[model samples]
Target: MSSISRPSAAASAHAETIRFEAADGHPLEGTLTTGPGHGPLALISAATAVKRGFYQKFAESLVTEHGFRAALTYDYRGTGGSVSQDFNPRHISMADWGMKDFPAALARLELVAPGHRVVGVGQSYGGQALGLGNVSERFERYLMVATISGYWRNLGGGFKLYALMNLVANPVAFLVGHVPSGMGLGSGLPGGVFSDWTRWCNRPDYFFSEEPRFDAKNLFASVRTPILAIGATDDPWGTPAAREAIMRHFTNAPVETRWLDPQEAGGPIGHLDFFRSRFRETLWPEAIGWLKGEAQA
Candidate 1:
């Protein structure tokens, strides 16, 4: 076996917990897993409502098995470890998470692993947020897993879930101060975060048509980084059409899109399972090779 190849849980103790300030001055919590040797720095961005911990095992594997110098995972404002303050009703938005929080995470990673090349690995909404963020151009390459625009029509069976968010969860979030934890959205979300997601998913134009807060076309047109977008054939939330919708926004990026069927992944690998530890034997190594520029779509 290679020197760096090891089980994910075996290297958990080596991870270092740290704090970094966001562009907006919000203190964000993160964990940095240092590899056995120096290599590229990886910033693993989590999906919506997903905590930094959700990516811990994946981050550990990247450092322990893939030869990355370090892998950083952080929580967005108002979620997970970043929610150290009283946020009965935090006034944050999805755009803030994309434009502000992600950039801050990038800056933090750059500081933590100076002189090392940076590779961005964004899962689902994590990938969407990176494209919309300001500092994405700083990365050498991007590996976006299950990334897609929140267009309701292209969601296949996921439209029901989006509809419920728009009609039920959103109202409860505004009234109850947070998205209900029992709803199983990885983690409970702030009212504003949930509402903003609903507003974007409910609209046909998604974030592209929104004004004042963002100019999606102009924002993504500047992206020239090589992109590798991986999607699942069985993921209703990130269907092929949905992925295309989001990829269309990155007008300048040379994007390579790949679809993996559950059978090829050894089981029913849906949107969430793409990053699950179980796939470490399958997709994980493929992802690492792709990020290293050792493989192609």
Candidate 2:
């Protein structure tokens, strides 16, 4: 048999790159997509395992179809092409993300699209980051898709066991110089991000049990941004009760929650599929309709 050969392509076109100094002074990398008209600036944030390019299709829709002035997406520290391994990997915390990289991204966006209203669209872990970022009045609107504010109680038997393993793996990570496994919905985040996730997962209030710490409650209460929360009826991490719990945290802000059935949204769509689904053609139009204050029911 003949050997297989890799496909060849033309030279790559250059995309604009910008670097921001995070609140903690870490350099963060981002990509900017300028739109054809002056409209609200959209800032897209990705989940832990997802890179900035993960939002490419969505960003295109926001600019070309929705008329958003600009869309900016970035990788968190230690993920994607941003500064990697600059911080301690063994003991990273979500608080560090909220305090550092997220704020830097916001500052950079403000500079790039000065005097424009900003909207945040985040998915999964990225949605959680948006929730944390909402404590400030920086964004004009928020859209959280498949977000987890804390943890889900009923993530099935496999997730339950994975949660148990994370507790043991976190401390071991520090000793072995390995990242904690099972920190993400899938696998393999940076050691620092993984450790932070492990700490949050083991907490009773978020995942393993319901006895959440008082600080966790305060963290939820502090967020005052208006929001549109979206979830799938079949999502394992976003079960009805779990979604409601997340909504309860945003009582201080005006919130609209949408629980979509797969068939209704076009076809069978789960958590990740919501973004990668035809639902955008159908579901997003409705969501955007609601966001534009057009559909009220």
**Which whole-number lDDT from 0 to 100 does residue 210 have in model 2?**
26
Q: Which candidate number has the best lDDT?
A: 1
Question: What is the TM-score of each predicted model, taking all chains together?
Answer: 0.92, 0.81
lDDT for model 2 comes to 0.63
Q: In candidate 2, what are the lDDT values of residues 26-135, reduced to their tens digit?
A: 66787766656566777787765677876766666666667677777888776666645666555555555655677778877787568777878877766666555534
lDDT of 1 by residue, 1-297 (tens): 002222346543367677877766777778877767566888898898778887888888877777777888888888887875643344877787788888888887787567678889999888887678877768888999989888788787566777678777887887877896777565888888888888888877788888876887888888888999999988868887888888998888999988998997898878878888888898888878878778555
| Candidate 2, residue 259: how far the Cα is off, in Å | 0.8
